[model samples]
Target chain A: MPTIVVDVMPKAELLDPQGKAVTGALSRLGVDAFSAVRIGKRFELTVEGEVDDDVLATARRIADEILSNAVIEDVVAVEVVE
Target chain B: MPTIVVDVMPKAELLDPQGKAVTGALSRLGVDAFSAVRIGKRFELTVEGEVDDDVLATARRIADEILSNAVIEDVVAVEVVE
Candidate 1:
């Protein structure tokens, strides 16, 4: 089955404290080169039926309506392997 | 150009508090069906050179070495829309 992954972020456009904390930890771990780190989310969904354009459309609609808060956050799709 | 997205999570197999917070908010937002929501990260990295197999290999190496905490977190590569 093809999994549908969703990455949702806060819409307020403010600095993500959680992300910063993680990034700080990473910097301590010796990855200090990157300037900033923004944390979001990852959702893997298993589509029961076929993987088609219609499914994608429905998924996009759902993302817009319920999965993501467009005003404060952004949603991106991560493709599944197999 | 293609973007390389990295999702890093906690490694120790414990409950993710940040994820739980987001899930609670999502449930309040009327998405009560999905039992849980685990928050990770979404990183958009622009590969400076080329989008080739070698680059992917290097990126995966970097993910393993610095980006993801293999002990507790899982790393998944999301394809970029180019």
Candidate 2:
């Protein structure tokens, strides 16, 4: 079955405490190649049948409506994978 | 500066309660196109300088060791992005 992938990330303007904590951890651990770290969510929706136009549109709708919180997060990508 | 994106996904054998809850929510909302849903993590690491081989290697190593748990999660991808 084909799968639709949705990528959601926190708004760039918002502060990501989780990412900051990880960045601090990395700094303490002597990994300084990275200056900043941001975390996001990746969702994989498995389709029951072929991924057609309707299914893709439905996925997009759900991604924007149900999967992600519009105020804090943005749906970055919606792609299909075999 | 470039960014290294690392994707981490939970093990397929394990039961994902959050994913199950979302699946149920979708079903109740009359969205039946998807059969299953899995949630994962995406990390964006901002590099201080250019993304070289060493930086890529470090990103992969940190992805496996710190970004994800070996027992429950797998590092699916570690790629550089602009």
Candidate 3:
């Protein structure tokens, strides 16, 4: 079965406390290659059958409506994987 | 600054209750194109300089050791994004 992947990330303007905490932890652990860290979500939706236009459209709609919160997060990508 | 995106997903054998709930909700809403849904995490690490081999290595290490739990999750990808 094909799968649709949806990537959702917090708005760029908003503050990500979880990311900040991870950044601080990295610095404390002596991993300084990264300056900032932002966390997001990745959803894998398993399709029932072939990935057609209607399936892709449904995935997009779900990505925007249910997978992510529009006010704080954005649907960055919606791609199909075998 | 370049960003390294790390994708972490729940272990395939684990039962994902959250995903199950969402799947149920989707079916109840009349969206049945998908059969299963799995949730994961996406971490964006902002590098202070160019993404070199060493930076990529560090990101991979973090993705495995810090970003995700070995017992419950797997690091699926670590790619550089602009």
lDDT of each: 0.61, 0.95, 0.95
DockQ of 3: 0.95
* lDDT digits (tens) for residues B1-82 of candidate 3: 8999999999999999889999999999999999999999999999997999999999999899999999999999999988
Candidate number with the higher DockQ (2 or 3): 3
Error of 1 at B11 (Å): 10
Evaluated on the second chain alone, the candidates' TM-scores are: 0.74, 0.96, 0.97
- TM-score of the candidate numbered 1? 0.58
Native contacts conserved, per model? 0.28, 0.91, 0.97
Candidate 2, residues B1-82, lDDT tens digits: the string is 7889999988999998889999999999999999999999999999987898999999999999999999999898899987
Instruction: Looking at model 2 chain B, report the run of 10 residues with the lowest lDDT sum.
Output: B73-82
DockQ of 2: 0.92
lDDT of 3 by residue, A1-82 (tens): 8999999999999999999999999999999999999999999999987999999999999999999999999999999988
